[model samples]
Target: MPDLNIPVKILGIGRYLPERRVSNEELARLCGRSAHWIEERNGVRERRYKSFETNAFMGARAAENALADADVGLNDIDLILNASGTAQQSIPDNAVFIQRELGERAAGTAAMTLHATCLSFLAGFDLAASLLLARRYRTILLISSDIASVALNPEEAESFSLFGDGAAAVVLSLAEGESSGLHRAAFKTFSEGAELTTVRGGGTQFHPNAKMTRAEDNLFHMDGLAVLRLVRRHAQDFLEGLEPGLSAGLGAINLVIPHQASKVGLRSLERYNWPREKIVETLSFLGNCISASLPLTLYEAIKSGRLERGDRFLMVGTGAGLSMGGLILTY
Candidate 1:
């Protein structure tokens, strides 16, 4: 097969977080649990909260910063794609709000939202690449933001200890000459395990009825054992499939930004022999922000100099649909 030649290059990256920082101690106190119990299980010592800003607001902030980093005005962008698991509302798509914030300068730009649970950001990346390759746009802005804490059961010790709010953005443009950014990506799903991780009542399955108000049914629920089994069985298969074009040695990968679902999930990938130093973790401090986690981690890693030009990075995201995706990028 011929190599798929995609011209997408990451022009800039940006991230934003809510002002409130919720520590494990505070969360434990709120949930009537011990801090040690939360830490030992989830490795989450702290997480951010979006008490002041909504998802769209946070996403706009990140998108603006990304545009600035790319040295482009809002008018330069031809498209905007917001990827989030949590939206401000069930309808009217958050991308519309973001377009409004960008002003008349973006009047000609196309705006939309893409949701595929935790893999949403990667899905956006793929879409943007395709659009740019087809000459549909010169530059596309991709933002991943989520206010996952709002979906959690404050009363559930597990959920209370492991969720955060944050947003991150990336700008992708056609490679002008010979730059490297997104090289290859693959996405897959295991629908049979879909019931293992999901909210039981909010959607069509159960709908929002009186029975849906039950604490457990209302909150995000997961069968940890089932998730573990699935991750263990599938993560390797997913990564191995994309390993060929990665080029860099496993140890040379500056970071492996896996979805910040749980400490257990992160550690399971480690057991697959991914280098510890190369693994960028936000679960301990930010918990899982769902679709926002990998991009937020990437933004931080770049800021802290953990990711550098010529450094290869791998992203793996898995979420409620029992979906999994892998993407390899060269910075």
Candidate 2:
């Protein structure tokens, strides 16, 4: 049986990428490297930048696009869930801003956020699906948006060169129509990697006002090699934790939309027996959009005709919390 017994479907999907394109050369100049150096190391040729775009602004625009794509109206969304990797602000809740930007169409609705770093979007997907099954919400707009550029340390070329800014969102509803339904969802974590990938500053532990806060504390950092090694070490167990459902899910899904985390990490999925051609990747061009990575890649897959309705998919990735998550569903 699938993880989710109740049928749920994505009614629409949308993405908003900034017009300012940052090529490998531009990022290289910032880090004192060549374009080839960056690409050869991380498989990133270029990435998008918010420039003047706020995370909330990009999110709202993406939400609009998704609503339009789903043919869903503002009034149709009963819940607005911001499942972003980072909030635009520490207060006021970024979801409210997204709701306002969605115009009056989003009035009189509940808005909230569910955070798990890059895994937030996948968490939101299951959240919306569960709510639909419980009949608490008729429709949901789940969004994932992050601007890693601002928090990046240009001096940390390995990490800095691999980030981009963007947002991707989806409209989900109970499978009352003829569209495909959500079939399964699963998430696993090894908290030992909690500090492996993190933005050590801006939170309660590393606040700006803290006397001992170092400048680098506020910047995003990842022990890239360590993370890859950890994932590889736990690869079999992690995949096994996903169980019989996962085994079948691998065969059942038509495409795999993975988090655009790293070149080595992505290629490792093939070791699980997944077909190379069946994986959808956007890390080379889009960089890692944090929480937006999965959905952004999903948008790319759909736009490129790699995905179509009635298709089965497995969305999976690892994130800051040392988390591994994936979902099997029919699109």
Candidate 3:
């Protein structure tokens, strides 16, 4: 008998990029730096910034595309999982807002949000697999949406130019055949570097209503070098633990869809001797959309015909929790 506990299979994938494209030149003017400086550091030429899109609006748009790709409808989705690092509001979860944007047909669908900074999508995929295997849901809509551009700090040119706004969605269902499913997954968190990347306001600890809260406190911040150092120290071991040949090279993997963290982060893959051709990246155009980065990259790979059914690929990234996670899947 086929193993009934395998990871959920992806039925369809979709992405939504805002119409307003912010070029590096625009960011350079805002940061008082040259466009070349921004590109050289972040590998981003341009990134989308929402003119009128909300997190829910973008996610719903992506979800509609995914549903169409899957040949399904909003009512067909039993659960909606928003894996965004940022929410539309502080009260109800982001998934609820997505459902609302999806219209009345999705009114009674179950909704939840899973957040682990940039690894939010991976966390949702992991959880969805388990829930599907347990017969908890028939089909699930997983979304990762973030408006990183709005929260970016212009004072921090490196990080500010490395972020963008976008959303991606995937339709997942139980594997109908043994050929496609998640192979193995692993994650590790090192809180010692937790302060390396953070947004200090909006949460209870730094509530916006608090008199001491400053506008700067709500902006995004990152010590890229510090976070890279911590990830490098443990990446090799973590990869080997997830899958044997992964540590040595990408010989067994067809493609790698990684979070568009930064130019430095993508370059780090070179250390594993993984061929540049085998890695899928969207940083140059989309920039880092927080948790939306990975899934959006995956969508691009699929649309570009880089990943195909029965091909084995790896999805991995480091998030603000100072966490690293990997998922091996047969597409």
Model 2 agreement with the true structure over 1-331: per-residue lDDT tens digits: 3356558888789999999999998888889988898998889988998878887899999999999999988887889999999877899898998998888878778999999899999989988888988899899999998999888998888999998999999999887756577666778889999888888888898889999899999898899999998888876766666546353337667899999998877887887778889999899989999999999999999989999988988888888868888777788
Ranking by TM-score: 3, 2, 1
> Tens digit of lDDT per residue, candidate 1, span 113-175?
999988999888888888888898888899998988877776667866788999999998888
Off by over 4 Å in 2: 177-179, 243-249
What's the distance in Å from true for residue 180, model 2? 1.7
How many clashes show up per model?
0, 0, 0
Best by lDDT: 3
Which residue pairs in candidate 2 collide?
A: none
Can you write out model 3's per-residue Cα lDDT over 29-63, one digit (the tens) per residue? 99988999999999999999999999999999999
Q: Give the candidate number with the greatest TM-score.
A: 3
Clashing pairs in 3: none
